[model samples]
Target: MTTLPSSTRRKLGLVIDLDTCVGCHACVVSCKGWNTENYGAPLSDQDPYGAEPSGTFLNRVHSYEVQPDDGTAQLVHFPKSCLHCDNAPCVTVCPTGASYKRQEDGIVLVNEDTCIGCGLCAWACPYGAREMDAAAKVMKKCTLCVDRIYNENLPEVDRVPACVRTCPSNARHFGDLADPDSDVSQLVAARGGMDLMPEQGTAPVNKYLPPRLKDRLDRTEEIDVLAPFLAPVTDQPKGFLGWLDKALDKI
Candidate 1:
């Protein structure tokens, strides 16, 4: 079985803002497109246009209606992918050492060449991040777009993960978690970013910012702050509108 490194040089991961994710799936589409073209074996699909279509995807968005004690029911869009955990069970459970964690950047990856299409990694992963590519017959998961991140040919701005780049709402972030001064780390500190299932003890690198509750609209006792703006300028037509109204009335 494989073993994890004692420590990694950097904890590179994502910081997802639950408040801003719009559930548009742009990240999912971009991930599929980029990985298929540049990364390892193509992500396969069976009957893509048919009724029962299924395919391998590294990123996915799941929406759920949640009700908080202090707020009304709200729809939350959650994007899930490989967390690249510090204590990655998938890496340690791999019999052939096909799955391993990088000591350089702390990215968990599967060695497809040495991978015997074994589903051990999938079983060991608590997040259900791994998916089987039907055509390639190999287990696949998110690689944090490792190829794009370190490429010198690409512009510095485009070095982030495809999900972070394509997020229309600017909900996704990528940076070194090991650096206390990184923007991602600062955002996490400001927003109180939390881990996914801390009870699992996987120590996932990715963090999620909790959605801030919307202002209550149903309460009648409290004064509405936008009352002035909500009030009309005048019930009767006035200014340019008054002139237009008089002309229309004459007609």
Candidate 2:
């Protein structure tokens, strides 16, 4: 069986803002495209155009209609992925030592070459993050886009996970969570981020910011279509033209 590192030097993970995610599946599509083209073996599809279509995917968003005690029912988009836990059950459960956690960044990964497709790691994972690839016949999980993140050839802006870069609503953020000053850490602190399932004692590195209650989400009143644009742009004249108008009046 595999074993986890005592500790990682860096806790590089994601900070997902639940309130901002729009559930458009942009991240999901980008992850599929990027990982298939740039990373490991292609995510296989079974009868994609047939009766039942099933495929492997690293990141997925599940929408739930959650009714808060104080607030009305609202649809929450919960994105799930590998948490790279300090006590990863999947790593320890791998009989062939194919599953391992990185000591440098705490990113849990499966060695596909050594993997026997036993599905033990997938069963061990609590978040349901691992998937069985039909074509590769191995367990596939989020690698944090390791190939793209550290590639020197790619532009700096494209260094993050494809899910983070392609999130249209900017719901996903990737950075070193171990760094107290990192943007992801600060965002978590400010937003009161929480782990996926703290009771499981996995010590998941990735965090999720809770959705803030908004009065607008539940209000049944009809919105005035022109209410916002009705407001005046400025009491004073607009920029350059305004200055010219004033100068001409003075003349």
Candidate 3:
């Protein structure tokens, strides 16, 4: 069995906003595209375009219709990935020491060369973040784009996780959670971010911003109904009215 570090210097993780996410699946597609080539192993798709199509992915977006106490139903888009817990059970259950957490940045990663595909790590993960690649027979999960984020050849602005870079709604943020002054940490504090399933005791580093409450419109006042037909004009005016008449004629 593997053991985690006593503590990490910097707990790097993601902060996802449930309110701004549009369920676009852009993060999913971009993650698949980048990680398949750059990371530890290639994410494989089995029988793509066939009757049953499935593939390995690091991030996924799930949508839910949630009805609040105010009586308005809202569609919440939740994007999930590895939380890189401080006391990760996935690391403790790995028989081959393949799964381990980095003490520097606190990113959990698997040693593909040492992994025997025993599936223990996947079984131990409560978040269902791990997946078994059928083709390579190795366990895979999100590395937070370790290759990209640390690559000096890439531009500083492009050093974030692929999902964060490609999010059209800017719902994903990455930074060191250990630093209270970091942008991600400040955002979490400002939005009242919360960890998922805190009772599980994974001590997940990632935080989720809850959906903002929508302002309920007052319905006590009666609405005035518009007339079904417009009143006939006595005579068509010139100049601006002539242009309006021409546009109405086309309509």
Can you give the TM-score per candidate against the true fold? Answer: 0.88, 0.85, 0.86
For model 3, the superposed segments whose C-alpha errors exceed 4 Å read 218-251
Comparing candidate 1 with candidate 2, which one achieves the higher lDDT? 1
In model 2, the worst 10-residue window by lDDT is 215-224
lDDT of 1 by residue, 1-251 (tens): 37999999999999999999999999999999999888788998899999999999999999999987875889999999999999998899888888889999999988888888879889988999999888888889999999999988999999989999999999999999989999999999999999998998899999999998577778743667787778887788889999999999999
Q: Which residue pairs in candidate 1 collide?
A: none
Error of 2 at 45 (Å): 0.4
lDDT, each prediction: 0.92, 0.90, 0.92
Residue pairs with colliding backbones in model 2 are none
Deviation in angstroms for 235 in model 1? 21
Compute the lDDT of residue 128 as modeled in candidate 3: 90
- State in Å the error of residue 199, model 3: 0.6
Of 2 and 3, the candidate ranking higher by lDDT: 3
- C-alpha-based local distance difference test score of model 3: 0.92
